[model samples]
Target: MKFGYRIIFIVSVVIFFLNCAYYYPFFSDDSLISLRYTQRFIEGKGLNWNDGHPVEGYSNLFWILCTAILGKSGLDLIWAARILGLACSVGTIAVILNCFRKLHVKKEYVFFATLLFVTTPCISVWAIGGLEQPLYGFLLTLVLTEVLYIITSKSFRRIYLLSVWLGLLALTRPDGFLFTIITAGFLLFTYRQTKTNLLTITLAVVCIPTLFLLSQLAFRYTYYGELVPNTALVKVKITFHHILHGAFYTLSSFLGTFVLSFLGLYSLFILVIRKKDLFGFYLLLNIAAWISYITLVGGDIFPAYRHYYVVLIFFIFSIILGLKLNLPNWVHNKLQAGIAILIVINVFLQYNIPQNHRAVEERWEFKGMNLGSTLKNTFPDKTLIAVTAAGCIPYASELPTVDMMGLNDYYIPRHPPANFGTGILAHELGDADYVMTRNPDIVIFDVGNTPSFYIGEQLKKNKTFTKNFIKVTASDRDADYILFFNTYGNSTGIKRTDSELTIPGYLFRNNEDNAVLFTKKKLLKKMSINNRYEIILNDIPSKNWKIKNVLGKNLEVDTEIYQKNGQLTIIMIPKKELLLESLVLEGKD
Candidate 1:
């Protein structure tokens, strides 16, 4: 293929990955929290600091940059952040392609290397998500690419460019400091023979990232009280055992998520076996150091692969260089074919599978309820509604909601305030003329447990004090629980009730050893057991109770139970060895 077509192909692959990113929801928790912070910052709130102390738990530079470009409100901010990530991803790919071209590597090698970096599941997935990893990876790769140029051309301009990229990289992720250290070491060691070039690269490299870190530290001290954030301290306290576990996890993650990551390493191994040169040695050392750093950080291993993808790209470039200079045509062709097949499979999986749709699924399940519509349709527009689920409520309902979560530190005043649970709930409920508690309102307790007497007592007190209280939805099926609206207060005229019951589900568990149980909660009293009746118990049922089917943990049963003298009993003997928690009597109205 022509060099121009290869370049176009690379660019197309990058764009295709960026396009694929749109289908996945913003799955990163840190990204979501950062978005919330960005919204707050744009509203004039300062950086997060604890108790008037300067601490750096999080740096909102990327989010600020995103909000500045995307504007506040709507889902546009997510797209904008993703676009910025895509730009970095595309730039990283371009750097790799250019480096291969400059190195006089074979076109096939360049294409394979570029394909490895672009289509690797780990890199591609994160390139589209709103996170700093892809951007960090890109900047790191660009710095390395610039280093390659500086070494080849000995240009003062390349040195300066390297310094700028290093600075931006540090600003992107704190780990960029390692890149600065390693690069400085490499320059000093190699170019000691040329003092001028050595000093220029060393000074520029040291000052760039150092200045960024110091400025961030200053900001931290001013706002949060410490050089490093409390969050970092908390993370750093894990045991060495956890670190080892994390390393293994990181390895498994590479295998599972980025299938080509291991393949790229295998290709590097092949290159090393063929030609063990200084470049190959450096590639191995870089990979080892990068992997060590990731394992030491003990971060989410899968995500860390995404964060350090630039290192993978660097390795790919080295492999291409090695292959072109040493490997035979037959060997190179076979490797290229294997890599192409891997890329095709990865791309197919990316398109066909909804791997990252969990975020959207959560949002739809939890946030799609029309709080405002539910309220306006049932009550007056002016009626005040207090909700414990504050974030979703405000977005879904047009009416003002007292956020029990204390998000943004908004709460109603109270004297001799209640505990964290009731105090917050009271703060929300006190000013409200109406209260809406969705399924499992108590939060700590579900329908299986008896309702809290204190809650009912408090409601009774409030009702007596105000001489006005009415439960709108009281039936078990009406709403799982009741919504209280004031009959005498300002909310007197408004009335609303939801007939639909959001069925609360519970996971089945078996406390018995070596047994599995599966059952739903709140089963009916009288039920006919037929072949379709599946009973999953911790222990196997008695021989008397025929097991029609034994499929994995589930046991299908066919039995008859008839009420006798106001008592219900099954004819089959209860298994003495079978331990039971609670029986779920199903199929009864």
Candidate 2:
């Protein structure tokens, strides 16, 4: 039996590794946010989001530190992050298996539970997401297992290990402090029964984690000049409106798949009632606190139940326990078969539930990367660009960017709109006037597309912005990139000029004098037929001008010239794609 169980465990681990390998290539956009910071730090820029501007935009401190250390060894930062995440994923699995073994869970039960955990998409997919969640999950599991061990064995010998893990967990994410508090409260509540040294236990449970928290706070204050991350200021809000949205986020993530959601909640309810099992009771409290905290903060923006990953193992363990306790003897005999069926159903749902959503994120990330590279090649290095999707575009472009949504900005988060929480979470903060003051050479709304957020709308209404910035289209074979370009900025490629062909009593202000000066320089994108150019020449007696298509005979173009009342009007009908050197009108006097 022992040999068979050993084989099962080894096989389960292999399957879990394969699951991670399958999802390893799909990179999350938000994960790039951390990598960008890592890249800057490795370049000796410190924790500054942009150059010389320190803002605690990222929530993962230790994850960035670990990745930066790997990066210092000349590893690619993206791969560094992914490799660290893979290590953490394996560590989490090993810790859980060890915990189960120490608890003396039945070999058959452990095998089934391990199968359920390894098959869940949330675990496998998120493990390779290049974010801190995998590390967070690993530390959380170690801490939870230690708590369970202490509760079951009635021994405080390894309590110090719990303290160290708790401290590390808190460093992984800001909300990790919640678990520290919960563990401390539980220890204090059960102090007298254990007859342990109260002061010693307090030092291990409370002091160690508090010291970790304090040190981070000191670093944050010293480096960024703030105690809390700017992200918390922008995103975290405690209100009835946010709680409702968070509840919806939570419900949608769970109810999006009925069987899995039902199993988790039902198992948790059963586990809560088993008061004799102190581990189950403690888990219930932790989950409740977590739910409330996530609810208050308006939930997460990323799909695949990002915020719920830390407690995923607890839910899986409870489901296994619930199945064992609630089912009849006949069903218990086929527990392994039942769990194997559940795993199959879950794999099917995983494709639709999170995998589809992940595909959408990947598409946007790729688009941002393409757009950023184009902008980098087209624009001057000093040319500043503003954007709403603050991750891939800015990182790929390596440009100084103004985060329109204020995730990495210093000004906007401090001055949000009055009715902030009523709109989309974290997207409610924007100051059009403030952004205009920066005078960005190129302003990209919704990540190089159209305007979709508050700042974009605000900028559209500003008269100064409308007068100064001209909306232009730069098209290539792949797609059309739209952005607002400053009309009067230095380093000129396109400029508005009066028609050299003159006629009396006629002004050539075609489309508010928005004319392109074909300078023969390679623009960001090829000029498509969508571009229009009209010029009216004044004081011209007759239509003596002949239109010339400089582009070779392969591409067709239609040009019209009309003369009325000694005024010559020329219109370049964009019938085909043209380069900057396509049109040249010569006079035949």
Candidate 3:
């Protein structure tokens, strides 16, 4: 292969590795939900729920396309989707390299630009994740590159291609409408002399989104009885404070990722001093304007830095302009080397950060466990599991569940709580045979105390059922305790011995008190619980325990234990909630 092709191939492999590493565990909650939606589509359940409520938390076009092509039980759908993203990211690199070569940019500048795109931490991380960002980044780069081409060539054919790309961009992200608006403004301002050609291009671009919106509107009206789904629930109230906060956050996030925003500023200063590179200036202005617009209209801004992927175009042109401008060879080379080093350091720091490592590890373990399979094994086939979302359970176990959050409008008739709390739980558990919570309580510190009080109060006040089920704690990696209230009579009082509960390759420990703990042996070193070690027994019922005082390992307790329904209920209540900073529960089956 030629040197350019070889460079492209290496960059492609690097992008693939970065994505795979980032999404190594593969399926995330977001991807799992998307896959479930696609499966529903395949099953002819319609886009809405069985009750005909409109499902619109997320856009379904991508899911529909994937399901149509890949079929059901192709369980590694996330990997497949990420591979598509990888292809787009690689395509973006090719387009950038080709655009530079065609513009007669310096070979060194072209290589550097390619490197910047390939190693960009923010872009590389998203390329393999289940989000639509990589696809958006690729299409945005391609569309903008074509826009530049159309400006220089002024060819109707190039303009037509631009229109096609604009359509694709809109399909990928709703924000693509902003791109369409900016393009229209650019054409009217720059191509007044060729009014007819500009009009034709603008019309072509407008028609694609116009048709798409109309079809969506029709679907919404038919299914949701409104033009948009969940619009009423999710409102955007933009204030000056919000805009200012968003602007500062967006800039800070961008700088945090690239560290090139500072360098880009210096390069801008150099360009202005030389009075050169008008095209580069225009591209930079366009990017800046779009970024400002995004900041102003911010909704979900946690991952705002991902928006800066569009700046790849501006970065490429600016570097080329720097090379072309009249300056001493040594000065140019030194600046280039410094900028490259800074970028490489930024990428390394961001990718290798301890928090990012933890996130990747956690996501992988959570997705790998197949919670659906566990639920099926633990409960009856006809059991109605009340989950925060219906994504994984339904697809994995073929169980009917009530989504507490009402995603995709699944529980429209039930009208579940807007938030996940007592209200949703109250409604869901009323009819549910068993309750399963990924995290039972919002506050992790006081789980035992709070849940016991809440459940006690609810049971006493409400006469929905006669029996108060016991809390069963199961050991899991992501959650130390899986607390559930089993209503079935098959709830055996038998507590299995440590030897009987042994799983090979997993650590099993049995304390003298018969408490069994399970964990991976490697993670034992990292586990610590400060100075205070307290164990709150879930079997406890009465809260009348008086602590004589903490004597070292054991606390003197004066309390009575009662056996109810052939089960031991012990209450080892703490004197104060804050006296103990950490509490470690020894797991026993």
**In terms of TM-score, which candidate is strongest?**
2
Report the lDDT tens digits of candidate 3 across residue range 1-589.
1346457557656755665565464334445556665656667776543234556655535434554356554655656666766677777777777776787755666665566556555555556655666677777777777776765576657666666677666666556556776676666566667768667865765666456556666776786676555422322225465466557756665556454554455565566556554455556566777777656654233232555666655665665566556446767546667656865785686676543344355453243235555555554565454344345445564455444344444333244323312221112222121222211211111121223323233333433222333333334445543233322222211122322211111111112211112233111111122222222223433323332222222333233334455443323333332111111222222
Query: Candidate 1 on 460-541: residue-level lDDT in tens?
Result: 4443322333232222222332243332233322111221111111112112211212223221111122211212222222
Question: Per-residue error at 541 for model 2, in Å?
Answer: 30
In model 2, which runs have C-alpha deviations exceeding 4 angstroms?
1-6, 21-24, 193-195, 257-261, 320-332, 354-361, 490-521, 524-578, 581-589
For model 2, residues 525-585, the per-residue Cα lDDT tens digits are 1334645555544455453666533443224556677778886666654567543333445
Least accurate stretch of 10 residues (summed lDDT) in model 1?
499-508
Residue pairs with colliding backbones in model 3 are 516-587, 539-570, 540-570, 540-571
What lDDT score belongs to each candidate, Candidate 1 first? 0.48, 0.72, 0.48
Better of 1 and 3 by TM-score: 3
Give the root-mean-square deviation of each candidate in angstroms: 15.9, 6.3, 11.1
TM-score of model 1 vs. true structure:
0.60
Enumerate residue pairs that collide in model 2: 502-538, 503-537, 503-538, 503-539, 503-540, 504-538, 504-539
Q: Clashing residue pairs, candidate 1?
A: 53-224, 53-225, 54-223, 54-224, 54-225, 54-226, 55-224, 55-225
